[model samples]
Target: MEQILETLLFASDEPLTLARLREILTPGTSEPRDDGQDSVAVEIKQALAAIRARYSREDSPVVILEVAEGYQFATNPRYAAWIKKLFKDRTSFRLSQAALETLAIISYRQPITRAEIEEIRGVEVIAALETLLEKNLVRVSGRKETVGRPILYATTPEFLRQFGLRSLQDLPVVDENASQGEEAAPFIPDQGAQNPMAPPATDHQNN
Candidate 1:
């Protein structure tokens, strides 16, 4: 079972949650009720711990990490220099400047409407939102309890994993005395003065 879990974690591109692991590993089984008792969740936890410990050896080249409440294997940071040279195409995985700005807004003022995001950025975000959606970094959390019940957007677990953040609380702190008490600067792109996540450009790539 431990080995199976480890393999799944290695193969999965996303974090594997405890409930998800339990469902796949011990479906239909009753959950352990008593504290310190044996259960599928407990077993999975212990298995993950063992794998993490094993990879923590000084000679290990990779490490298992629990990010966004799921387990995944990551290259040991010590080998970052070699990995960067080996992964030359990694730049394509990064969000464009526009997408980064919109994502930052969503991350901080989550469950926000498109209107609110645009207001913060002072620019339309249709293109940025689409890119973020296609990447699974943002999700439609729910509808706001406002007059029109506008759809609310929020960052997903994938966002946390991508950013190497544990949770929203891990977001960089802002100075309380800053202007509007906002973060020092938004993720404005270099060409933000001209085009900001322009939808035509993003869509034209598919044509």
Candidate 2:
């Protein structure tokens, strides 16, 4: 069963959750087992641990990782430099500057509609939005309650992990503080400007 799980994970393009594994394994009643345990949870946990230990070996080619609450196998991080160098000239996976700006706006003003983003940037951003979606950095959270019911966008868990933020509120903000309570950048938008999607003011600065 563990070997089956490993093979399925290796063949899968996306991370597989425990529930998904259960669905696949349940139908294979004749599968062999090591611990003779009937509790699926215990067996799964044990299997995961064993897999972790096995990959801890220095010679392993792939490593299993738990990301976004699912398990997947990826080439070991130690080999990442070589993998990156192999694809250094590829442009498909890289983002353009405009796309990055659009993504920043979406990240900060998530659950926002396309119209709102356009309003803030003073430009259409369809391509940027599509690129971000393709990269799995953003997703459709829901539709706006407005007349057209435009789709709302929000960052994914992958975004948080990539940025090393524990939560959304941990995102940095430009300070407006001064000694003795004097205002700095008083004319600049406050918390609202903190939105990732907001266009940068002429004097705006990152924290």
Clashing pairs in 1: none
Candidate 1 lDDT tens digits, 1-207: 778987887788877777778778878777544354756678778887666555553335666666676667787655656677688768747788999999988988998999999998899999999999999999999999989999999999989887765567767765646776465643222221122222232211121
Over 60-87, each residue of candidate 2 has an lDDT whose tens digit, in order, gives 5576766544677776654556666779
Worst 10 residues of 1 by lDDT: 198-207
Cα RMSD, each candidate: 11.7, 12.9
Q: Against the hidden true structure, what lDDT does model 2 obtain?
A: 0.68
lDDT of each: 0.74, 0.68
Instruction: Give me the overall lDDT of model 1.
Output: 0.74
As for candidate 2, its clashing pairs are 104-196, 105-196, 105-197, 108-196
- Model 2 TM-score is 0.57
Evaluated at residue 89, the lDDT of candidate 2 is 84
